[model samples]
Target: MHPSFTQRVTALEGLRARTRQATAEFYQKPGVMPPPLAPLIIVRSSGNNTFSLINRATGEVIAERFGHNNATSHARELEADIKRFNVKQFGRHLRDWALRISAILFLFAFFGSHA
Candidate 1:
């Protein structure tokens, strides 16, 4: 029989992929205003209590929004920034976020030993 852990990992990946796809589709839909894509790295600074985004490819820092820790506000800011960023750059940033999130999930699944 297939290992139970293997099944769990697969399920996790599927969930992540679906979520990522939905987010992307939302930005790409017609008549939907897209955000700027200057920040390659979107960080929720625990200490600063602000949302920060960094564009590593261009070494540029776009606008930082406060009180955008929630999903709706974060998405709005991202959509705004996405318009300012190059299409190619936006693609790269999206891929980077996806990879980073996937790695985080992998670590939690593989290393978090249960009692």
Candidate 2:
């Protein structure tokens, strides 16, 4: 399994686990580099796996496949993929921002209307 694919799949699974099991979070290996984003998941493949990061929102793969020989190249690729994932899913962040703005707007509107 290609380590990249393993990591990608494991990360997705971790996300799913986090959703399903409230107490569950991703486990980081003993000495692995910490993942950059919150709720990050890390995986190390043992050389026979192929992996891709599938954007669960769009059912599209965000990263290319990692075959056996390509394991060594996964770090940079995974980092780049993570960046792309964040940008592509910026809507989630935007939605949160919008919700906060709406709440403030609602409060101001209520006060303005009364005053």
The residue-by-residue lDDT of candidate 2 on 24-70, one tens digit each, is 33234455554455322233443458655444445554554477445
TM-scores of all candidate predictions against the true structure = 0.31, 0.35
Rate residue 93 of model 1 by lDDT. 99
What is the lDDT, from 0 to 100, of the residue 96 in candidate 2? 92
Local lDDT at 15 for model 1: 100
Residues forming the 10-long window of minimal summed lDDT in candidate 2: 38-47
Highest TM-score: give the candidate number: 2
1-115: candidate 1 lDDT, tens digit per residue: 4799899999999999999999989989889987754545555443455665545566455556566555336655666666677989889999999999999998898888652
Off by over 4 Å in 1: 40-55, 58-115
**lDDT for each candidate structure:** 0.70, 0.62
The candidate that achieves the highest lDDT relative to the unseen native structure: 1
Instruction: Estimate the lDDT of model 1.
Output: 0.70
Model 1 residue 17 CA deviation in Å: 1.4
- Model 1 worst lDDT window (10 residues): 38-47
